[model samples]
Target chain A: MTVLINSETRVVVQGITGREGSFHTKTMLNYGTKIVAGVTPGKGGSIVEGVPVYDSVKEALRRHPEIDTSIVFVPARYASEAVYEAIEAGLNLVVIITEGIPVHESMKFTRYAKLNNTVIVGPNCPGVISPGESKVGIMPGQVFSKGRVGIVSRSGTLTYEIAYAMTKAGIGQSTSIGIGGDPVLGTTFIDALEMFREDDGTDAVVLIGEIGGDMEERAARYIIEERYEKPVVAYIAGRTAPPGKRMGHAGAIISMGVGDAASKIKMLREAGVDVAELPSQIPGLLKKVLKK
Target chain B: MKLYEYEARNLFREQGIPVPEFRVVSTAEEALKAAEEIGGRLVVKAQVLVAGRGKAGGVKLAENPEEAYRYAKQMLGSEIKGELVKKVLISKAVDIDRELYLSIIVDRSIGAPVILSSPEGGVDIEELARSKPEKILKIFVDPVVGIREYHAREAARFLDLDEQTLKKAQQIVIDLYKVFEKYSCELAEINPLALTPEGSLVAIDAKIILDDNALYKYPEFSGEYVRDLSYYEAEAKKMNFSYVELDGNIGILCNGAGLTMATMDSVYILGGKPANFLDIGGGARADLVERAVSLLLKHPRTEVLFINILGGITRCDEVARGIVEAIKKTGVAKKMVVRLKGTNEEEGRRILEENGIYVLEEMDEAARKAVQLGGAI
Candidate 1:
């Protein structure tokens, strides 16, 4: 019932022989993600952590036709090419874990993915995890447990932090996705909200956002426009951030007097979302909404 | 990174977009000589990266070379929007019949490049956008398709230009897009794109913000346009950490950008002020963490350091070891509240506790402790 991924979802690891790729492949595999094949170009015929590696995504697809998704841990320079390879191979989903890809490349590839009917999750994201069922990202497995609350965020460790807090409060999640902290992303809060709204297992959603773009405001508008029925709890970081200063993440900035936390919080509240001032308040807000 | 107006103007001129003839000079004497060469009423502009330069009195129109010298003397070494004006751009002033706005920006929401054009153009463009968004014409250009002839024509027509002027304006739009694409600019702006009395279009001002990630392709600009980094910030950049200085006391350090920002927000909310935002980035080893700790401890505003690490790819023990190593190396006895969780939490905690530093598992608890110890109560 989880959105994007589930236990049966077949996965291919792009850049599988690389340090991050190899490490996360084992981690995802340990979390019971159905990682069927790996792609590392020159490292074809090599096996990484018991998974067969292929030179190309096409070759890997030929060997494991059951592969439906890809998690890319390629370096930033080659990350876009890897994404295009996955998209052209007709993989349904491609999650990019690589950070620092050029915005132009991401814009082009994301558009290409859209036209090709493929879902591109992140260029600088922590991938997706369906709690106990599957973990495709680099998030710690212990912090998340299977439940009905769908979580989507724009951060990595922050997502883990909030998820851990929720887990500590005995509130498990249906799926937690880090949509990435890049300025241009393939999947946004609105896109994840749409998927969450359709998922029968997700009774509510927790949106984790930060300063930077107008994505949060846009998501709030989408919710109101669609008259979305699900009770959504939200948390936005960077309330104290100054204007024009990039707060670590490339996309996390209050620039040109727009995309501040105050405006985002206001918009989300106007959409009837229970926006928590602190990450720890999320579980309590979710409990209150789900109870209704 | 934001390019100086003169630098942006150079790029625009190189791309065949007509800009007022200009000379970039550092000295007032150089500016006078340049103004004499131009032989016309000129605008002397301070070359600062900050916005609203004109409003900050960083720009002045001079009637003659003597006035240009006076203006340049007044501007150079002067502060505009908190940025020191080290360079001045002396340009031949154009006779403007009308002013318009044009820019190509990577619109993140649509995931594509967008051209925004308006008949209204100036320092007040942002105000115009906020008050009357409809006044601006937005044309979303697909990155694959790029800026076509029609896209430019559409923009020119939006500004209600006459047939001949439309053709020239359209060409400018197309050329500007080329500059934007060629340079991998986040924003390529020609504010106050002036229509001269004789109907020729001239870019009065140029603003191009190149994407920092794509700077490798343009190595010339990589070192030049880093927009004034503070001492600590520059140090952090050298160490490959994301750092932003803030006006606070508690030095906040974490593994991820979002987590660092969240930690800062939490500290602020809990009556504590964060000194800076520092993300050691994922998979940071002990040496990097050690350097980061030393850097934070060196900050004068950092009374206490709050280190929150929710390790996924980043190992906890590595961070803990770095903290211990930093303390030993620097011998700066600053109070530190360390929160080490996720991978190898027990080992990390043990490493810190062995060095007489107690660790908190909960982020909120650690933040509270740092705030309390920092005397934010």
Candidate 2:
């Protein structure tokens, strides 16, 4: 079975009245995702891009009980509230596309969501996509296609860049998820790697990471400890990023000794995963692993 | 953001932790009056955020109000660790029986909050943790259960205080934990939880770094912008954009954070040094691009401007137009290297070319062009 979502997965859009919410709503629909309902605080009983809008997640769930996944497009302040509402409504997967969320707020909700057994893809991240079958995030649709490789990353644009490079090199993906680049996030590299390990559609893995966080190093330890035999290719950015300054993402900083790219690459290579020197070099490395 | 010592004292005072009588003053005359009001022996401290203020001659003890004024006059307008001293905190100096250390920090490794305490204090904890590991006590607090009285007792016990001192120290531990939790601080610490000669505890110096993300809920957080930022930094802050100035010649602008860093790496790899790291963020419009370009060109060291736009969600044409508009408005003839890819590349290239600005097809070539144009400027 495919991981996360398939073509039959019913979806709800939070903050559907907002510009990003409405735009991505159309983008997802165009990519053949099942858009069942929409939710905004005050804009109920209306339709957004031919999809019904409700005042709250509760109302949306009541109207459409088939809804299992929610894509959040709310702003930073109300993002946690939206996630809480979705968790309360019993949705299994919630993908947040909002940026600039506070670390404490993110920590509270991520901890809360984990306790409830709900899967959250991002708070300040691009959401997930299962190629050909279903698309649930705001990643450009033209760059992806249905295939056998499983992909996971902390970066958004670089995810698209590498995936495009892979597609150009005749490699395609089964699933690609952005776990967000925040300091504290709901999902980690290991979580996605574990999912890819179990999924029958995925034969190998490509982990895209950047400077910051011990998640990549921890994932390497998990790989070696579990002795998972699937081929994994990794690409980590920010090789020239300075120490102690945040480079865009809340989580992408080199502070207090961990999360540098050089150390991450060394660890990944030691774990038997092929680590690429550049984003453009990933596909060739992946091809070599697949041939072996 | 880190709170000044005097500001941190106020927070400690509110949490029921005892602080020595103090006044925060901006001028030398005000420092004299504050010294007089506090009476007794006075400690004149330069209120800069940097550490090792004592070694930097930022901290001093005064025998009289005139001496206090003299110290404040010398410290103010002086540079401490490259940051200007804007305010001084004058506190009644306490005669210490012993110096002890206590701190509650957000430990990312434990995935929860933790407290560190030591019988030996007034020294850097990092150095202590390195040189004398066993002297420090570490206790991790569970998030769901919250910090408990037992946790505080454990920390006090580890510090090896007597029964008489243990009860009061435990209360202070709990109070510190409360400040850490309530303020959404990454760290809440008192380096020297001074043991006064008269059988009382006082937080002589303290530091609290609030989580920037959680600052939204703390509406008063805006009033805490006390740091002296560089010219472009303040302008960028006012515009609600992320801009960092560096000592280099090539100015850069990119949409996403990862892409921006990658661009910088490319610049450095191709022998170009980026003057600043400017991220317009994802989905930026034409006007934002214009502002970003103008700001980059405004820097005196900038020899060439590099704009790398991978327009996935953001349209490429808008970026191209922003470059043209910015150059036309600012009239800054600094050389620019442009790379426009992803969505609508052809039309974006057309827009730039029509405006007499050339767009490169490859990021590598564009970076090379920028470096060659800069030529070690």
Best by lDDT: 1
Best by DockQ: 1
Model 1, range A132-203, lDDT digits (tens) per residue? 898889998998988999999999998998899989899999999899999999999999999999999999
Task: Kindly report, for each predicted structure in the order presented, the TM-score of its chain A compared with the true chain A.
Answer: 0.99, 0.98
Q: What is the interface RMSD of each candidate, in Å?
A: 0.8, 1.9
Off by over 4 Å in 2: B109-111, B132-137, B197-199, B224-228
| TM-scores of chain B, in order | 0.98, 0.94
DockQ of 2: 0.54
In DockQ, how does model 1 score against the reference complex?
Answer: 0.84
TM-score of 1: 0.98
Tens-place lDDT per residue, model 1, B1-377, is 88888889999998999988899999988988999999779999999887778889988999988899999999999888788889999999889988899999999889899999999886466798899898899999999888899899899899888898999989999999999999999999999999888989999999989898999889888876345788888899989899999998899999998889889999999899899999999999999999999998889989999999998889999999999999999989898899999999999999889999999988888889998988874
Give the worst 10-residue stretch by lDDT in candidate 2 chain A.
Answer: A102-111
Q: Which CAPRI level is candidate 2?
A: medium
TM of each candidate vs. truth: 0.98, 0.94
Residue B280 error, candidate 2, Å: 0.6
